[model samples]
Target: MLIKRVPSAEAPLDLLLEADPSIDTIKRYLESSICHVATIEGETVGAHVIQPIGDGVYELMNIAVAPAYQGKGIGTKLLEHAVNMSRKLGAQRLELGTGTFGYQLAFYQRAGFRVISVERDHFLTHYDEPIYENGIQHKDRLLLALEF
Candidate 1:
């Protein structure tokens, strides 16, 4: 698999939507974010988006792997690449928002990110549709950060 930076316009929207459900939100961030794609045999299989939020901080806007390629460490590779890229770009820290509970929360924790705060009712207020996992609705957003 190969992971490399690509123009935001060239990012795989379908794959990205696997993580972020709102197309409007994705497009809003994509306008200023740097996108990276993971491909194998010329087929795009995973992707991540990172945006600078000023003061040497960056936000991991989205990360996703194709369903067929899930559980194969593709997401991990993409995340690691994002971290490395942020370091190279002089980022003081990397931050992201995710559901308060889920595999995704644990995934970032395993990668050294720690919970910073919680945005109550973030999903409820921001997203038009309710987000669910394991049959439970996601109502809060946990802000996590990895300090450089």
Candidate 2:
């Protein structure tokens, strides 16, 4: 597998939608962000996008691994790459928002993210439709950050 930086605006829509259902939301930050992709034999499998939100701080707005390759550590690799890349770019902190409960939340935690706060009813108010994983509905956005 190989990891490389790419133009965030042109990131594959299907893959982006896999992690974030709303095109509008994706468009909100992607156009101006930095994107990294994970590939195997030249086939794209996962992607992550980050954009600066403040001085020395960046927000990981999107990250996903295709269903066919979800559990193979590609997502974690991409994350590790992001962390290193962020440091190179002089970032002091990295942040992201995910559902309060889910593998995604746990994934970030395992990567050294700590809960900062919760945006109550974020999904109910922002998403056009409800998001469910493991039969559980997503209601709030769990704000997490990794401070280096």
Candidate 3:
């Protein structure tokens, strides 16, 4: 597998949408964010977006792996690449938002990110459609950060 930066225009939107449901939100961020892709044999299998949010902080706006490639450590590789890229770009911290509960939250925690705060009703207010996992609705957003 190869992980490399690519223009936002070249990002695999379908794969990104697997992680972030809102197309409008993704497009808005993609305008200024740096996109990276993990490919194997010239096929994109995973992707992540990182945006510098000033003050030496960067936000991991999105990350996703193709369903067929899920559970093969592709997401972890993409995340590690994002962190390294952020460090190289002088980021003092890396942050991201995810559902308050889910495999995603645990994934970040395992990667050394700690929950900084919670945005209550974030999904309820932001998403046009409700997001549910394991039969429970996601109503809050957990803001997590990894300090370098």
In model 1, state the lDDT of residue 36.
Answer: 95
What is the descending TM-score order? 1, 3, 2
lDDT of 2 by residue, 7-97 (tens): 8666887898999999999887887899888889999999988888899999889899999999998899989988888888889999999
Q: What lDDT would each prediction earn against the true structure?
A: 0.96, 0.90, 0.96
Model 2 regions more than 4 Å off: none
In candidate 2, clashing pairs total 0
Better of 1 and 2 by TM-score: 1
Cα lDDT tens digits, model 1, 1-148, are 9998999999899999999999999999999999999999999999999999989999999999999999999999999999999999999999999998999999999999999999999999999999999999999999999999
RMSD vs true structure, all candidates: 0.5, 0.9, 0.6
Candidate 3, position 131, lDDT: 89
lDDT of 3 by residue, 103-136 (tens): 9999999999999999999999999999889999
lDDT of 2: 0.90
lDDT comparison, 1 vs 2, better candidate: 1
What 10-residue stretch in candidate 1 is worst by lDDT?
A: 2-11
Model 3 residue 23 CA deviation in Å: 0.6
